[model samples]
Target: METDSKISKKTSQTILKLQQNEITEHAIYMNLAKRVKKQGDREILQRIGREEGMHSKLWSKYTKRELKPQKLKVTIYSLLSIILGYTFVIKLMEKGEVVSQNSYALLTKEVPEAHKIYLDEQKHEEALINMLDEDRLQYVGSMVLGLNDALVELTGTLAGLSFALQNNKLVALSGLITGISATLSMASSEYLSARSEGNADAKKSALYTGVMYIVAVILLVLPYLIFPNSKYIHALVTMLIIVVLIILSFTYYISVAKDLPFKKRFLEMATISLSVAGLSFIVGILVKKFLGIDI
Candidate 1:
């Protein structure tokens, strides 16, 4: 026999989970606010934290229990905000907010206050979207250009060298030299391109491009350097796997930060890079077989 004043067992359980989430987020927002140096950023975080705490208190009345924040989760989001930037961390948290949003809809029928909390969550999203104007996000284009070029070019180069050279050290050395040369070439090209386009900070653009390119090159070339000469094939396999992982990770970051589609972007980049590597490997085999050049 259900009554208006009686909370259902299932709804209570959901409220408990939501209560914990609200409190956890309250702690994360407070900690993140402390870490940032910008006054405006701190204020925005503090406001959000206050709202989260208020919601937690609202939930506490229903549960009749005081719940502590998930300290580990708070620490993790704080560290990520530091290492990756507040925008990324906040947007990642926004992804979870969507699930919470859905739960709010379900709970609305059971609890009248749920609707108001749901509206508050919507406001939170709006606030989060408008609050971040980080400078680093502006250079995402340069980073993407450098990272994509390095992955496609170096992945192909290494795949070809693996078969043609049949020696891990030789492949690694060649890949490193090529990677370095390409990094320099890319940085200079980016500098010139930015300058021609009237960008005020062309040097910074070049720096981001160069740094991302070299980072990708290093990750791609490491397996070759680590493997034994007889395991050139293994190195090639490992390098390909690393390529996919880099694509997956970077694509996800861009998707979350920029609010873009993830699956389509990932599939496109992975397809292009892997296809180039595969074709290069085939070319290497044909070159070795037809030319009869023994390494």
Candidate 2:
């Protein structure tokens, strides 16, 4: 490792930034480790935290200046870990480390230890992959089933109802009734399916599915409820937009956690969902005309 005897001002500033980042990340890992229940996972996070602390020390040597961790960064990442799950927060942090890894390459000439730090960062990614054991992730299929079914079925139902009913309040009322009934039906179906499959946590799986479905129902129906005086077409458009956003968010989460392709999954789900809504819309128009129904 080269000494800082001839380091330039710019190089010193960069070293300080790296030192800050390392120490801040160390705090994040340590904070999350303390929150986790599993001893094995806690130990791994502590080990990584110690490695980050060592990297900060290495940078401190080059700058010959003491560095403090950024409290804000630590707090933000800690909160994200609590809300989004440790696996997601860690993966997100690793993505940031990739940027730091590039910066480390630039500093290798001035600080040879940067190369070693970069290698350790790569290892951290692999370690995180092995440490992921979130219960929600294990039952991702149940959530997916619930979310997708609600999106496709409710979106189409609402679309058809918008045309057939042609009144926003009526449409909202009809949607709420249908959504609640379907949520219960879906929950019971999931419970039976999981039980048949011999899943030990069949009840929990069913609860997750039902909760996810109800969440989707509430989100999709909100526009109708909130804008009951608006045009039904406007409400339908808002609902579709909400559906697309939900698909994007859920697909991105699955992509990051499961190492799946984002674009393909997102496009496929969105296409099927929208296609069903479109067909349902046309059917609604035909039925309304044939039945000569006017509200």
Candidate 3:
């Protein structure tokens, strides 16, 4: 009787495995439906896919089926592994809810079934979010570097140029124009580079970088508009602005990431800003000598 019972349990476990595989496979197909633009069609398909797996698990659990000792351990381990792996990936996917919501905006484009799956996943994501602490540095690092880098580089570049060009209105105008164009170009280049690394939101980092650059340029160059007669004066005022920008950067880092030492942070920013300025000064001297212009 015990042998017969064991045989029955093994048969039930085999059936559960088959059912779980079928459901998981179907779920993959339903997910792929998005690539083919079958959003609504994929919704029902997705639910069906999930139901299949649930049904299999429910059956095995309810039946007290004794799967082979090794196989049962492996199955338990695999499930645990999946849950752990998806915790991080699912949060990332959740962060892109804005993108997914847009994907479902149009009625014609809406895959009702896919939409359902999305909604379900959204809830799942929310639950996961509640379980996980919110300190993951998803967009913050990119944004911080974008803003800080632009402020340092562009401010130093313009100040160095103002020193070299010294009070020529035309030279100042030319510098401003060049800086604006360069900022935009750099931003676009960064965005494309990030996009190649993967994900649409990744491109936003470049935009933020470019925007920060424009702010840096404006902060430095705005003083020149009023003091066009004395490039030296403009350069002096811009230096004051640079100091303010540096302090602000340090303050921001302190506020957001309190672990960094103030002196270390200040030195890092100063090193980069001064290094760029030095390089720009050299470039300006070479251009002035080669072109035979007094700029």
Candidate 4:
């Protein structure tokens, strides 16, 4: 009977975990549904929420205990849904369900209801895919173009200027001037390209591209500006770090929301940006040596 007691204790612990997860997910879905404006999307979220609550109840029956939803988890996911869009938060949560599938499989050996809950979890993925129809997803390409160009071009330009000028203040001034001019030029080019392609929202597409580009420029150039009249090498290192962080963050966001491969995309982008910067740095050194010009 001692062996039987240990097995029972382990099973009870597993049931409690499932119970917590189900209740937490139910609150997250319901909170997301409340934020959604579309009736169809809201209804779908509500239906999923109801099903999660039922799953919690099923687990409760075996444990013979009540479990409260994880309030902090629900709050965090709800805030993420508000800021990152419902689709992204839902997809992120669904990724967690993949891990829970193993737990459910273990439970199925003793509890028949666990199998039914596992099947319902599979159905939720399909429903989530169909329900996600956010507008920002459509403009992702334009944003990518803006962000990538700013990172590659500005990083190269700043690296070149840093060596050529050998002064942080001069480098910062030159970078700001070049970045601002490029922002306007890129916006205009995007507008023309969109119009030529017969896109109905040409102006909006251009706006999104331009805004993203400017944001990247500001972030990338901030180090130089802050460290002006001081350590130029330190500023340059900081800027490179910022570029990597930007690439990492944007790649992760795209990978999660669009179901793209993150590692390959991130490595490709980082390699290209750093390669250009390295080439530009070498070119800057050669030009300064050959021309005998110092600013």
Top lDDT model: 1
lDDT of 2 by residue, 196-268 (tens): 9999999989998999899999999898877756578888999999999999999988887776899999999
**Candidate 2 regions with alpha-carbon error over 4 angstroms:** 1-3, 98-101
Ranking by TM-score: 1, 2, 4, 3
TM-score of each: 0.93, 0.92, 0.45, 0.91
Q: Note the Cα lDDT for every prediction shown.
A: 0.88, 0.85, 0.52, 0.85
Q: Ranking by lDDT, best first? A: 1, 2, 4, 3
Tens digit per residue, CA lDDT, model 4, 1-295: 1222324666677877777888899999999999899888888888888988988898777777777888999999988888778888878887776336777777777766678767867886576666667777888998999999999999999999889998888888888888889989888999999999999988888898899899998998898878856577888899999999999998988899998999999999999999999999899999999999977
Worst 10 residues of 2 by lDDT: 95-104
Candidate 4 accuracy as TM-score: 0.91
| Pairs of residues clashing in candidate 1 | none
Q: Score candidate 4 by lDDT.
A: 0.85
Error of 4 at 110 (Å): 0.9
lDDT (Cα, tens digit) per residue for candidate 1, span 12-109: 88888877888998898889888878788788888888888988898888888898988899889988887778888988987876246667778888
lDDT of 3: 0.52
Instruction: Write model 3 residue lDDT over 155-231, tens digit each, in one string.
Output: 55665566567774654586588778878777887778778888577566776667656766666666666565566
RMSD of each: 2.5, 2.3, 18.6, 2.7
For candidate 4, list the clashing residue pairs, or say none. none
Better of 2 and 3 by TM-score: 2
Candidate 1 local Cα displacement, residue 293, angstroms: 1.8
lDDT of 2: 0.85
Cα error, residue 292 of model 1, in Å, equals 2.9
